[model samples]
Target: MSEKRALPWLDSPPDGFLEREQRIKSQKQVNIDVYGILRTKDVPQISFEVVGSTGNIYRTIIGNVPFCDCPDVRFRKVQCKHMCFVLSAMDVPSELRYQRSFLPSELREMLATLSLKRKLDTTTPTTAGEKKPVDGECPICFNDFKPKQKTTWCQDCGSNFHQGCFEKWRAAIQTSDNAVRCLYCKLPWKGDEPETPRPTPKAVEPEQRRSKMKYPNVGDN
Candidate 1:
């Protein structure tokens, strides 16, 4: 069998192309906020909704035909800044970022290695006490907060909890009559009102293929 080829873009890249791509990858202005990732179980594909620096959202996909719906890729037929941002943020290897196509196994491996950085929610009201730094074990899960892990703070006590663990912990005790309370101090979470229950999603048929994961942009703790 013929050796599997990769990185077709490098065959004849423009002068300084690699350098420009590297700058894009490291530029802080290339915001990746307000994005969602879709990974399918049946198909070895990962899709991203990456928000660009100008506030425009672009679709970047990694599959047999890696693609980005952006002017640079569409018009110039080159890897665009958004594509570079996605690959770099997802920790794709420097050598593999310019690959023209990806294999099923390669896609699966990329998904397995993906590490998302959680963003902080600026809208959450600041509590009375000094905001504590993210440290120590989550009161509910008792797990140490990994760097950049999603977390929410107790408005009353200023203690922090893993976002997922806090949601589960809050749900168990929150009632219509009572407000959600801090797990550590038992003080009523000042700004955290009882959440309205969401309607259950309709069941999917067995024959219908569904995405394995949909990762939302949950900003860091």
Candidate 2:
């Protein structure tokens, strides 16, 4: 009977492995000297496994990342030198760090956190030179409507949405409420009012004709 054997590469990777792989693959060269760094062993020991050029197997332990120069990693997608080198440099043993897969919600939270951080970092107060008057013409109307103009602002998204566009946009969304803001641009507009019943016009009564005064003619005769 043949003995059962384990397949070499049947495990899933960590959260950022694919992105990192793509980025690493895009790079022409990685300068981390895997052998030199591994020899010192000052930092964490990162185990690397890579297939090098012409089927050469190169392995090195360095910093928190691992590097490999094998043909599998470089020419083919089986395994690459850069990934091995990065793994070795990072001192991640074969199994522990690979289990760090993030859920969808966790990934969304991470992305949101990153976006918030970026926004906060870029939130410098505007200087006097940066302040500009709102003199530009409206792109939709092809006419200048200053800031002081009595126009409804879109609350959902702060865009200079025209009133006509707002009405059309609101109608397109098909809401029968008394007032509705546009779904697309978020501009506020009044909805159709409940029509009051108008009274019908009445026919005027004909005035009674007065009899001619025959008494005046008798007095004259």
For all predicted structures, in order, the TM-scores are 0.47, 0.19
Q: Taking the tens digit of each residue's C-alpha lDDT, what string does model 2 give over 1-221?
A: 43222223337764555565454444322221112312232233334332222212244332223233343434654444355334323333555233323233322343344234324312444432232233443322323455656344333343343454333333322212234553223245322333344333234211111113211110111
- As for model 1, its CA RMSD to the true structure in angstroms is 12.8
Q: List the residue pairs that clash in candidate 1.
A: 118-219, 118-220, 119-219, 119-220
By TM-score, the best candidate is 1
Off by over 4 Å in 1: 1-16, 29-43, 115-221
- Give candidate 2's TM-score: 0.19
In model 2, what lDDT does residue 86 have?
Answer: 45
Model 1 Cα lDDT, one tens digit per residue, 72-166: 78888977777666666556777777777766566766766653222222223465674667876554443467998888776665667777656
RMSD list, candidates in order: 12.8, 32.2
lDDT of each: 0.55, 0.33
